[model samples]
Target: MQEERRVVFIGKIPSRMTRSELRHRFSVFGDIEECTLHFRSEGDNYGFVTYRYAEEAFAAIESGHKLRRPDEQPFDLCFGGRRQFCRRNYADLDSNREDFDPAPVKSKFDSLDFDTLLRQAQRSLRR
Candidate 1:
């Protein structure tokens, strides 16, 4: 099986940082497939840099490359796994009751009668 591409999570990133700047900074370590910065309105912003090769991602972490600005403290870096990134944290999971169950999703199409569906399709065509 092919090895999965590596992603590095950078925490405490400045909200003003741009994709180009991140790409330039990590490019020295290896070819970067993508760089994404997640900006939050009420919390600290973070970013993820994906490398084309897994070795390059490991090297970048091992080298201790810090993302710092002229007068700001350096940002922290760590290897990010897909599961860790996607899964909810312990605190969030624990807040919910053990018996909690999400309501079944109902599709709009399923609830609409044939006449309503036909009218909606006609209205869409008019636009």
Candidate 2:
């Protein structure tokens, strides 16, 4: 069996950087399977770039690739991990369920029972 290629995590990306710009930069190394950009609350951004082959991923790392932006410091690149980045599988949860009935969501206060409303009011008063 062959080793699986992992997604590469590039950190300290600029918020102004576009997805196309990122894709173009990494494409030179190999065929990128998937790419994602994550913007943080602190104003800095980060991203993940996954190559189709392990050899391509290794080439990128050995080359010490960096995202070079005009008038800004180059953003460094590194190997993320073999684990699929930020992806979740919910198929198992859905498959195990026989029924899909979900609880009704109530929006209007008038839809609630009178006794339930009174209890809520009492709880608010205690707070």
Candidate 3:
């Protein structure tokens, strides 16, 4: 079987969370080749994150947290593909970053019930 390419989606990170900061946070799980932190306006503060591998991506997704904003709404999580990797574009490393929106945060997700997700991932991984 092929090694699954993991693509995790971390949305609604505090607008204050910088790309560097996000990289640091996620890096705790595993190696993160690249990370982009999206921003809304100057300080509206909402965006998404993506990781390179599946295990690291999954670990990040499992660690749930409420948005740092006043409303403190919970956001969704998942993974996606790196555009450059698909195109085999070795020349334009920055192209992928350009396509990534660091603001508004991805809206769609597997509900906000993190407990359910944790149980599911834990159960599935054990098998």
Task: Using lDDT as the measure, name the better of candidate 2 and candidate 3.
Answer: 2
TM-score of each: 0.58, 0.56, 0.47
Error of 3 at 87 (Å): 10
Query: Which residue ranges in model 3 land beyond 4 Å of their true spot?
Result: 1-5, 42-52, 64-75, 82-127
Q: In angstroms, give how far residue 63 of model 1 lies from its true place.
A: 2.8
Give candidate 2's TM-score. Answer: 0.56
Q: Pick the candidate with the highest lDDT.
A: 1
Displacement of the residue 111 alpha carbon in candidate 2, Å: 51
Q: For residues 1-127, could you state the per-residue lDDT of candidate 3 as single tens digits?
A: 2234565566666655677876776677777766666665544443344555677767777763532346645656665444535545434444436665544556545465888778988999999
Candidate 1 TM-score, true structure as reference: 0.58
lDDT of 1 by residue, 8-112 (tens): 887777777787887788778898887888777765777888888999988777764454667655777788646544446433442336876656789979988
- Rank by lDDT, descending? 1, 2, 3
* Per-candidate alpha-carbon RMSD to the true structure: 15.7, 11.5, 16.5
Q: Which residue pairs does candidate 3 place in steric collision?
A: 6-54, 7-79, 7-80, 8-79, 9-78, 15-45, 38-102, 39-102
Clashes per candidate, residues 3 or more apart or on different chains: 0, 0, 8
